[model samples]
Target: MATSKPQVSPELSKHYSARMVAVFRYGSLAIAGIGFIQAVIFAALGSWVVVAMELSAFVGGLAIYFLIRRGHLAFGILAGQAALMAIAITMGLILDVPTADAPRISHLYLLVLAALGYLNYQRGKSRAQLVLIGLCLLAFIVLASAPLTSPFVVLPDMARTIGTWANAVMATTLLAVCIHAMQAEFNRKDKFSRDLMTALWNDEFQLAYQPQVDLSQNTIGAEALLRWNSPKRGAVSPVEFIPQAEELGLMVAIGGWVLEQGCRTLAEWSKNPLFRHLSLSINVSASQLMHRDFEAFVRDTLVKTRANPHRLILELTESVLVTDIDLVIAKLDGLRELGITIALDDFGTGYSSLSYLRRLPIQQVKIDRSFVQDAVNSSVSASLVKNVVLMSRDLGHTVLAEGVETIEQHALLARFGCIEFQGYFYGKPMALADFEQRIEARIKRLA
Candidate 1:
């Protein structure tokens, strides 16, 4: 039997950006090495002033590296970009003379900084970073057009030639490394996205039924969870792929498949006395609800499968509400008119106002697991859960506290007047065959 504590999987965004940490760490070290090598070359050429400037660059890179290691990643990136721009501008204007053999190549480094700045800004959306990137571009254009009068610490012909080649190679190599890492990350994601498409075509995904119970511990229903067991990647968590699916515009198609399978299961259960009364909840994404033919699709599925509409519950997250409210309400109401129940899933974790509870055609409110798990220990969580139950009841919406992984949590929720429950505490999600066997076992025990 699977354990009661369901493992929490990180969301896809977190997983997707995890590679950036490694990239930055190694990239910082590489930058520091480049600075130190340049300093050494200058020292060998007896250019004391240039050697000092190069050593400062080395120190600056190390400072950024240490800052990142200390968990100040944003600050580290900002500092690194700022320092690189300063060095490039200073060198292009003063130290790096435009010789006949080696024109001012220091300005080219600004282009690299600009690229890095853009990448950082995309991730953080910082206005300051955007401004810095603009400055880098401006500096690059200005420095490339004409060399400034000041040529302090002019390098010897030998040093300028050697430095030009060294600077070009190092800067180009740095840019190449970053691009390569980014390209590899993109390729991996692209491959995964392709795999997802192929998975749908090959039927690599299956549904797992997790039992939902009443406060009395009696099984009432199950939530149909989508599971993907990739042949190459083994068991992939929905948390790691669902967002990608949505971004790829594949969620509507995937959700349709889930609905079809769920309706078919309802049809199968209608013939079994033991499971006929059970309600099956399926999560609906924003894309699915907003689809033009969603209402017709659900209506047709119900008619084709001959499944009881009352036995189907559509769980929707708060994100879905951030759309055309009237349109959403109309679609939900249409589903409700057909005897399908609409549930607000992951309640209290979104930007939805209390006014939505009164306005939307929500038949049930599924309390998010974060609040439920902390309810027993956190006064704030307990109070929130209590109020949600009261408010849901007052609004004529059934309350289900999901992620009730312990007896204490279940008891606390019951005391708070929550009637319905779903979580690992009751039973982990299992295959359809296993779910049927579990239901039969429970029925026999009760008899």
Candidate 2:
């Protein structure tokens, strides 16, 4: 038995780009080190001032790279690195190239600076970067004028060329760098998607169970929530990747995994007499349920797990049933015949028609959290919850108020004839190990 329920992880963006930025900086640091070492080897040929500037850049780049690797000051470091590259290139423009070089060093450096800026432009410094790039381009024109455009920036005897060729080379280099950056981004995303495809059977996914309690504050059932923790991507929300899975034709496989895992949990929990009669509910996607073999799969899962069919519930959103009502109805009927409970989850937020209630074999309707959350403060919301409860009773279906977080909210819903309740108030979703202990403890207490 466990002592505490599983704590909810913090809400975070699944598609965070910080990892990629860190990886990019890791490469940049190596390049900066190489540049500094090259400068040292050729110190005798170039201006000492140029070597000194490269020294500072290399040292600063090293510091920034380590800071970003530690995940410290990420946004600031990304923006600063972009600005630093632009500045270093601009300043390096005034330096004498140690070896034979193109005469349009200033123009080339400016375009390179612009490309760096554009690559890191969307890293939270949009407008400032635009100004920086614009200034760099404008400086090219400013430097072309009389005093700024001296033929010999250094020695009087040094020959120079500022023809159509220099401009074309600069333009071509900038375009190629931009194209390369875009292609790199595309490749990064492609690799992430492919990794997720391979991750399905790699034990990267799992389920969390949130208890559903009745009016007496005793646990009777739970909703099994799907969660994934990717090795490369960190924690991923079903909200973020489930749609992607549907598009990639991975949902059927993922959904099957959920069903099997949920059944396995039930089989394990069946050891405790308290959990023997408890219902386990799992969400099914429209496509998952629409599959011809879905019923057979469910039946086989229950038989294999030795879980009673009466204690298994399959939840589907009301909107899912609207498009192919006839086909869905036929499929759902077969599920009900197996003594599996069917529920309408997130009930009121969708197009909830009495027609669905009358025609479908739904055993319960979960009142969407919106109305339950507002029921305490809003009279209209309270009335709506009451109406839903009464309607469900009239139609021989039970009502479960979801997201009931406060005593006042719970009291109001309990008065409205809601038979079962679920939310943060009763218990958060917990791991199977912790939830099993919770069930044992609660049953003992009630006894």
Candidate 3:
């Protein structure tokens, strides 16, 4: 009973790049080790032809390792997995004969290759990756049932028996490693989902308002950005957690809380002369908008907080329109009935259909930061920004350019007829109290 130790190098790697490097580094070594061991066994069995095949695996694996270390990540992954599949199939057909006691187990490595192939595809979507995965799966199934008649010298009975046990041990060990890596990611997400629910209940989730300003550089409004300071994980970016929340079906609840808090803030602002006219834009996820009672929820929050509906802007991304355009429009119309303004956020980043834009009850268009940042250098981006401004304004949508980080970018956006803006150039997202104080100071200076 020989137990094989599994390689789990990616257990502690956090970022995707780090995980990728760790997997490739360890996976390549493991492959090479398998090849080396098989080559030694076949050499002892006097299977010279099989020894050459095994040595090829050893060399191929080592080549992939060097390629990966040299930063040829994509090529390394594709070549390594493909080579692994070829070797697995060749060896399974030639030597791994299924017996009553020793079943054909070499083909089992194909399943591991399939898993790795899927992971690679997930990292980067490509047709070649899909083909590799399909080949692995097909090879696995076909080889599991029948082995082709080998022209090359086959392994002896004793060698087949030893090889079966070795293959079973190694294949299962590698398979477990893949499963553990995948399960680790799932477990992290599960833990995050639970933590998110607790954070919602404990009021750990917060909204930081990034100021949106007019051309006059006066603070006119702000977008409420979600932030979380987990006691266990420290401060987690919305980039990392928002999509998770959406996937876990928790965004609706989180959105409701944000709406409530935003409305309350609006109500408080209404009492201040300077802040009375300032609008607050709160982002609405596709799921939140599609929620059957989203309109009623907003109405209830408005009624409860007595927030001025005119001062509340719900920012919807272009991606949301892909879900159900008619339903989205209906929801927007219903929300509009409450006097809450609708603003399309992250413009030019998704499917922006003229027909859908014409139908959506939107009052504003936000130029995504990518365009704004690149507008200064790239003519294509600049022209796109200019055209988006013209088109959005033509549709009577107030255009706001986001991610304006410099005075030069700000000047370019202003020149392009985008009057309203939101970005770090004006002010970064800050606490509500700080935002109000900043706004107050600006008002004093204007006076």
**Which candidate ranks first by lDDT, i.e. highest?**
1
- Local distance difference test, each candidate: 0.84, 0.68, 0.81
Segments in model 1 whose C-alpha atoms lie over 4 Å from true places: 1-25, 28-169
- List, residue by residue over 64-91, the lDDT tens digit for candidate 1: 7887677677778788889978988887
In terms of lDDT, which candidate is stronger, 1 or 2?
1
Question: Candidate 3 clashing pairs?
Answer: none
For model 2, residues 297-393, the per-residue Cα lDDT tens digits are 9889888988778888888987676678888888899999989898898888777788888888899898988888888889998888899899999
TM-scores of the candidates in the order shown: 0.77, 0.61, 0.78
- The TM-score leader among the candidates is 3
Q: Least accurate stretch of 10 residues (summed lDDT) in model 1?
A: 1-10
lDDT of 3: 0.81
| Cα displacement (Å) at residue 38, model 1 | 8.5
* lDDT agreement of model 2 with the native: 0.68
lDDT by residue (1-447, candidate 3, tens digit) is 000111122221112345556776788889899989989988987888878888988988898888777767777878888888898888788766565666778889899888877766655566888999999999988987774555556567888787778878888988888887776656766787899889989999888888989998889988888888899989876755776677678989998988899999999999989899899999888888898899889998999999999999998877787797778888889999999999887788788777877889999888877788899999999999999889889999899988888999989889999999878889888899999999888878878
